[model samples]
Target: MSYRGPNVVATSNADEKTPAASRDNRTRSATTDFLDPLTETEGLDLVGILSSVDETAYVWDLTTGRLDWESNAAEILGFDDTRKVATGAAFHALIAPEHLNSRLEVFSRSVGADRVRGVPYRLQYRLRPCGQRSETEIRVEDQGRWWPGADGHAVRARGVIRIMHEEYLEQQRQLVRNDFDELTGQLNRVRLTDALGAVLTRAEREYQPCAFLMISVNNLAVINETFGIEIGDQIIAEVGRRIRSKQRGGDVIGRYSSNKFGLVMLGCGPGALRVAAERFIKAVRETTIKTSFAQMTATISLGGVIIPDQAKSVHEAVNFALRALDIAKSKRFDCFVAHEQLPPAEGARLRNKSIAEGVIAALDDHRMRLVLQPMVSTKTGKPEIYEALLRMERPDGSLVSAGEFVPIAEQLGLSRLIDRRTLELTVDLLKRHHELTLSVNVSGLTCSDAEWLTTLRRLTAGNPDVLRRMIVEITETVALEELDQSVNFVDTLNELGCRVAIDDFGAGYTSFKNLKRLNVDMVKIDGAFVKNLADDTSDQIFVKTMIDLANSFGMETVAEWVGDERSARFLKDAGITYMQGYYYGMPFDSSDYVKAA
Candidate 1:
């Protein structure tokens, strides 16, 4: 070994102690191979792994202050031979330009020192030429480090730097490719745009209702102003988590923008939409989380569009949902306003252009119709009352069921027209017959529109029989969620001589601590319990308890989905006063409804 370079820097005064010299003497007398590049790189241990490409092994010479031998270390540097030609400086030739300084520092430190610290360092360099050169260069870098051998100078360094380098590169690619919201680790707008089409296709195939909701962290702007953007961001992150925890795994949720999250509600029908909205609202508002600076609480406002039909395309559904979200944002900060149902206001005219143009035409052309579903009396074993179901006929001469298009109509602010048309049909049917009562299910959203409700009463004016015969079913969750506004709604209906039933008794997302919290005349049990009653003892017990509980509170109990004689008998015996199901009768037109009733 020899050195032809300038004078080398010796170890510091502190390093040239007596202990280090004694250790050096011990390394030379160990009777080990002095410098076998192969043994040092490959035969350092009994394990063949020491010879593997991942172990970076090199032979260094203290006297020369340079590498004397590197056994297949050339393989680590993108070659097969390290002992010939390139020799000592070959390793330095492959050192990446960026790592040149660090490599020099480590080499200088190792020579008159206790140890050669790094077995290998990562560097990207072109590969050995396999054929005629091409325009592109094949370069890779592998990463590895070292530990001192049994003796300091006689150290072996071995490891693969290419795969390691590639691994880190891949991680960088993923960091850029991911659609994660930086604040919450939730899916962001980038993910939503990509996944919407796939989700729509599945819903179309399954004949399921798919809803898209846009949720805003209400008062977020105020939060930023009052506290700070950092706290506001913290609140949004917490709100995102709460929303995620509330949903099932398969449901797609993402942050559409700052303070706004998008949700694709799966398998939800129009009948259950208000319930779903109230739940999403509750999930975010009810979350109490403490940040570093303050204890924070939040409310979320939501707006969403239910799928047009299982057959509708993904693009259509996304546009619809986004439309609804816009409407919700234009309204009160702490409220969810469906886009299609936004009243006549700025931009509403622009938003509702297509639906509004077609809806009035559809109505004028008698494209609107009604389908009455029976909600039979449990006691009489006869249909005591019929539920008025709405329907719309598309231009293709096909009827879109109320469960299908009422939401769209509502989103277009055309629900009052729907309500009016339905009432007229219902009354015309009633006048043509006698002894049949009809229950109309209306959106609790309309509860706040006094002019709309007043129009409803005036249209049905001079028809006390119609009013007395009507049971206006508003979802209990919806009423309770909007409790402050519901009082006036209840009073207005009572003045119109209408009986109000709080629909879906215990199906609320919030636990019912006060069964009679929202004053109402009757409680309808959610169909979930009744559907499983035949096999699930828990459901049987729940239904029985619900009935007993409702009776105790002077409210009538209606068991929905009573699909068989056994279910009907069990519910009747359970003291349920009302039952509704396919086994009883499917939805019919006004004439069939009256005849059946």
Candidate 2:
């Protein structure tokens, strides 16, 4: 068998035009099919039985000129997942190159005259997980025994089926979910917590010091924004698999952040963390993650902590381990840093105080003013309605951007108030300017607030125009992850004659999935790539592609950071429909825009 050979191609065996009754009997019963997963009795369904069998099992026949594949078999066999597998040349293209020859060899033996009946052939099987791995193959054997049943039709011979108890199945599923990041398919927070915690406790019980390693990628937000979430998830998954392969036994590792991973050491001390950290850094630097683009590398800041008593509650120790990771991140350490080396804080007081006070001052003086930035019609060069910007004034009467205050408000439990203030201000602003459409920013936590919704309803009750001309820029980064609330918020807003735009469109956990399902109107390109638009060809291609993408979906694209003429011109010529920038205007007083006009 060869990579280019047509002889190995599999053909579809599925009946394209079979009778309904025949299909029904061959397929799982409707109830069993509709209810994902079957009860013990329902497991008798043929489809259910197929699903319950080995994940990679395929009813393959190289002798059959036609290639046909089962959908489950395709997923297990590393092919493009389809309704049913196909046989023939096209099917061979999807098989892992390493497995094809061996599979063909097995086919030769399974059908030959010398092959003993009921004999099972053990094969080392590798099913590449679409893109995550090279085929983490498990060795399994194929047993062949055929019998003429009462109907005189041939069927595969097997033993009595042992149905798993419902409770056991549910528990297994929960365990899998706990251990995996759904987006990246790497281990998630819960899994990491359990795995690392166990390692730490065991180490402590053994009275041996253990190390914890944490790795975080920088500019993940920008990467996510540039590529869209589907690609970002792929990159993250690849990085995780690489790291996992490098770690030795007794070390537990899992996704710790949207762009970070945590590792726990069993017996290795501080030195082990150091060694593993070095290996990780090297792997990350040398390795290029495969996305739609062929190659890309990520920069990671790593940190570690060594606990002398590994068994004495490593969970809390993980916190200390995280603190070190933060230190490494904040310091921009290219390599790894240890926990003991952390510097004492000069209080980060100025930062926290500025955030806390900024909100308080904005609320007290009503400095939280809503300024509208038009999402202008690219075709008409006229206003399409404006997106809302919330500006705050300090005690000095200087205007502060939301960037400087939003994070602080969130940390201090004041985002809901800020959101309410912004919404109220937006409504009032709309009342004053009936011709303008205003967009307001709402965070995840705010969207989940019932009181805020009531506040919004009340504010817009008396003025229909205020409600009609309003658009809310819900940041995809926040809104999509908390899907139910996000959808409800958008539905309510839409009912109130408001539209919703996904803010920071590509910079989130599940951008593509959200775009496909999220109830949103427009996409705001994040400012980072736009900040350096003209000079970076890669960034330009990225931005241009996203603009095209939004247009294809009947959504408008807004170029953020249209900071200067150069970027504005670049974005404008690149077919971007709308641009927002300091070049056109810094978010200013409504009076300033009016005066300028």
Candidate 3:
């Protein structure tokens, strides 16, 4: 280190100092000089302190392009000689190729004003030793202050270089964790989805073929139930490993969900997709997963869609692949289904998309209205309760029935929203109309949705009268599907002073045992059995048996679809508690009913 300019000093008169005063003055002068500029000995001490922490200080003279580094620069930067890093140009050459321009841009950015103090900068990059291309490249953090020259450009900089290899490695690990699944070590769903979109774009641009496969572990739910979830996770991890081993070099695999994986195969046509699917299937089926608890054989079902062919976008590709997966699962435990763009299916898909958009818009716009259909008492033929059916009013002043869009809503995972909205409307109606009793149907998805129950409790909280007038109806099929959850749901409703009815009863083979366990308040016989009850003896017997069963359980029975006087009379004679049908009255808008009342 060298000083190249005149040094300014403050001098005291020699006549003013006594012998003792001279000693004190000398001590003060030494301290004052240390602050002006570091002497050679002090500079060496600073270098020693910085070097102990793996840091090196430097001073660059921009006009001369000379870099003066501390004495330990060679040792700190892993260089054999100090000359290699003694100049700005020589030092810049050692910066990794990718980081060279970025490091230079830091100084260039500090060109204008703000030189009153100095422009400060901090950046991290890799540096490779000169003439050595090995994995030992150093990661460094360079932070410094630059001063402007007369031309308003950076002329000199003072900074420190810190070795950041450990921090850099930790950051790399975090990136891996973000992009990959913890259990399977495969790409996570988010990264996989991004990768799918990218591959689809590339395939379209390059006019190449590719395929996306959604592979699901068959009977995973049963496995999780039979074994523990931990063992199930182990199975999933092992399956991911097997899939990775069988994938081609260009293919990508990711953990799509708990029991499913998504694979993207580049340059794969429909025929190649089938072959690849089979290869993956065979790999998992042939090898039994050995876990610490137990060894079990697992098989996977796959659904595939060709890129830029069957599907063009990421959304379409994922949806189509899931559809194919459903078909494969329905066929058997281990099967592969390839998505085909049939005309009818395409039309249905478009229609579903339109309905989904409409549903969302209607909900947002508060266009979801309820229609009330009367369920009349069997003995006196007077309206007992009104069933609230969901309807979406269109912009054209027409209405779309729940049947037209509810299934799609369920498929698109919008049932919970609709259900919550319905609960709110029903509670409001019950509060407004003191003489009204209403039954509202819920989808299967809502049966297990804790949020829906929370919403229900919130809406009817402190208003037990409203809950008492409200009847929550769940389909018989849904109730039997997850009997335990349905039982709990029914119990909660009953506990809240609300009645639970198994709607569309007798549609599914509901065992008397399960029906008894459900402990519902009412069973609405399937309209199919009630519509022809007057003429069809079989229908009459089934209806009679269902009525008998309900009566035995001390549950009320509501006969639905009683289209004519004869059906109603027969249902009433068969001891039905309530009857609902067009013959009694068509469903009318609840607001209109309110106005009439």
Candidate 4:
């Protein structure tokens, strides 16, 4: 018997002219004899068993590249003739190009491994039958073991190949589901962003133009409230469909958020971006959407940023587009706004970027330090407690005050780190100095930061003295913004034995009811009203009223920004418990203050 194919020599089984050929023939004979018992069993249906599982067993002669398969190999592999898969080279030719390398790599890596018992391998790949195109390709899972020859190379492999057409189809469907939005049948946000990054790279390399637009359906919330959420969803789906229809072949669109869609337009310049945005807005606006409950007219607002011109990176592209979209919405319904870099905003962005880098570096380099500002007792003219102020030292040793970086840190979501560090330093100081009473400010963001609270709990745990002497100060505006969360935060601090003070109080003109609800231990008068208390009658009345109300609630009042003897005397006469300002003393380095004390 002889086998013939492309890249394969017609070899006679009886010839065995070479040692490798002789070994291959012997291996084949041994494999066939091993399966002969199964075929001879009268009651056991071997072919039926293999067919039931859509599997075909094979013994591969690696040295001769010859392949021997079970009787059902051709039927299971969807080949018209068994000769099509008679050798490894022919079988490799049938493997889909995309998966060919993977199949080869698996076997290559298996070579030289422990082959006494054989090296086991399993892989999945697609195979195209002879005369069949890729659309009709069959997916098969091939799992087997191979034995190495004396040369430490794979010489023989015996394995089972199971057709996985159904599983392959399911996997393809799952991939589609993962890469596409269910409602819009468009690329999902993750895939769309990936595509955006790819296009941006191409644009930058080719020096072409691209634009990313953020289109928001203008009254989605109102529609949801007036009709129903189901109707709102219908509107969103319809809008997505309309936007997709208007997109160019090369353009990509995705549901970016609930009411917003992101469109990435290729080779589009500033002029083209505006035109595309208007076209998309018109597509959704000109036609009314028919929903389950009612027919509604939905208008969309568009904001876009041209790539490499107005935005350089994916993050900048998304943010700038959203910013333009906000401006468009503010102007009117069915509006289009293209992002133009404003000097001040650009400067601020650059400043923030620098600050963010500096902040992270400072934290890593242990350059963050605390300065103590004394809040003095107005009656005794003595420091009662010190407020811990955050300061970052530059590489040059110049200190950056909290006023410069704290707001930016909060905006950049770096406040939590700073807040945690502050807590640790404050607790440390309190533990070291038995006479020290310190106040540390907590950002509004930290109130919701469970990790920060956990850190606080861990540091002050079982240290009642430290907790009692520490005051957790929260600004009045922050407290009033989220009254319930603020109340809860204060309650937790109180429970932990830490005193809670409403800092910059009277700044928000906090209602008496809300103030009482806070249940705080003290209120720090807003400095704006206290600094000119002696000269400004209105400041005096506001301060006096705040003091009276705070006193009535049994809450102590600490006047801030008191800069003169008259203001300090007036605060003392007005029942102020403490006063803090330049008039009392400037902020001292915590270490220096500790040494001096």
What TM-score does prediction 1 earn?
A: 0.40
**Model 2 off-target regions past 4 Å?**
1-346, 349-354, 372-374, 509-511, 564-566
lDDT of 4 by residue, 1-597 (tens): 222222333333432343655545644553364366766675576767988889888887767777777777778888876555666777787888888777766665654678678888899887887644546677899998878777676777888889987876698799999999887787888988888889888989999989999999998899899898899999999999999888999898988888889999999998988888788888987878999887889999999999977778887888889989999999855799889887998869977988999999999998999999999886777998999999999986989998898899889999999998888888888888899999999999987778977998789776889888999999999999999999989998899898999999877989989999999999999999987889999999889999999999999889989899999888898889998999988999999975655
Q: Give per-residue CA lDDT, model 2, range 59-151, as digits (tens).
A: 322333233333344434444443333334444444468776775554434332332243344444443334324444333333333232233
Cα-based lDDT at residue 437, candidate 4? 95
Give the Cα error of residue 334 in candidate 1, in Å: 52
Model 2 accuracy (lDDT, Cα)? 0.65
Q: In candidate 3, what are the lDDT values of residues 1-597, reduced to their tens digit?
A: 122211101122332333655534533342233222664445445656767888877777665665666656668878765454555766776788888777777766644658787898888888875434555688898998888887777777777888876876698789998999999999999999999999999999999999999999899899889888998999999999999999999889999998999999999999999999999999999978999787899999999999988887888899889989999999756989999776998778877888999999999999999999999997766887999999999985789999999999999999999999998888889988989999999999998899988888788775888888999999998988899999999998899899999999988989989998999999999999987778999999989999999999999989889899899878888899999989988999998877644
What range of 10 consecutive residues in model 1 has the weakest lDDT sum? 7-16
Give each model's clash number: 21, 23, 0, 0
lDDT tens per residue, model 1, 258-288: 9888887777766566687787788766657
lDDT minimum window of 10 residues, candidate 3:
1-10
Give the winner by lDDT: 1 or 3: 3
Span of ten consecutive residues with least summed lDDT in model 2:
154-163
TM-scores of all predicted structures: 0.40, 0.41, 0.44, 0.44
Error of 3 at 81 (Å): 99
TM-score, cand. 2 vs. native: 0.41
- Candidate 1: global Cα-lDDT? 0.65
Candidate 4 clash pair list = none
